[model samples]
Target: MRSRRGVIEVNTAQIREVADGVPDVCIYELLYNENIEVIEDQCLSKRKCDSAILASDGTVGIFVKPDLPEEYRQFLLWHEYGHFKLHYDENMHFNFYLSRFSWKTEREANTFAALNLLKGEDIYDQNVIALLISKGVPERIAVKTYESLI
Candidate 1:
């Protein structure tokens, strides 16, 4: 799909194929396999952001607050990986301050994370939806995940 920021195209099925059963472990594995560095820095707490910065050296640095819960952290990592997979290049530096681009990019990344993390779940089942909700996933994301699965 083309957006004002740029052309955004992602093969979500391919990403699902790469994500294993466990979301956290799967994201970590994906990052390592892609040679993206995972960095946990408390300094990110000051930035008020939980996003990844793509460095000029082909390293994607994930800035996560120290106090972030495990599940949320996993989601953040996957979201960052989504940016790396869909938008970033070796020469591209992602600046979150670009408001229009940031919104579009963030939506795509959230979709990517939700689809990959919720893959194989029976979204048609109410129990599954409840489980997702219980895990602190936003209802919109859970619904979007169902749409993606279909």
Candidate 2:
């Protein structure tokens, strides 16, 4: 099910290959390599929102809340990159209120982040899911991670 941004075609095989090649793939480094700028900001105080992506003059800027935990912040970075990769067009400025964005858009981004960050690991394993949940992965994300691996 694709959203209005269009179908986000994620090649899990290619992502796996890249993950295998890189020692430690940092999402920020990946964004940098793609010429996307990342800014850590503490000004986004909206509940349930930790990041935003702005596209202008052919450049994508990702702003992440700096006050979140390291793991959560990393997740947010990946989520925003998902938006950049999947939803953003060179002419589209994606900044909008969280309440205004469709749930499908949010779900797509969350699924993208879960799959990419987890690297198609078998997060469905109950023990592994529990471990991830205990380690601060949101329950929704844990479920999405499991679903993506399938």
Candidate number with greatest TM-score:
1
lDDT string, candidate 1, 1-150, tens digits: 445555454455655554444355567787777677777787776786765555665445666677677777777887777776666665434465565556656666766677666666665645665565555456776666556555
TM-score (C-alpha, index-matched) for candidate 1? 0.70
Model 2 alpha-carbon drift over 4 Å, by segment: 1-24, 46-48, 92-101, 120-128, 131-136, 144-149
TM-score of each: 0.70, 0.69
lDDT of each: 0.64, 0.64
Worst 10 residues of 1 by lDDT: 15-24
Clashes of 1: 0
lDDT of 1 at 122: 68
| Model 2, TM vs. native | 0.69
Which candidate has the top score in lDDT? Answer: 2
On a 0 to 100 scale, what is the lDDT of residue 95 in model 2?
46
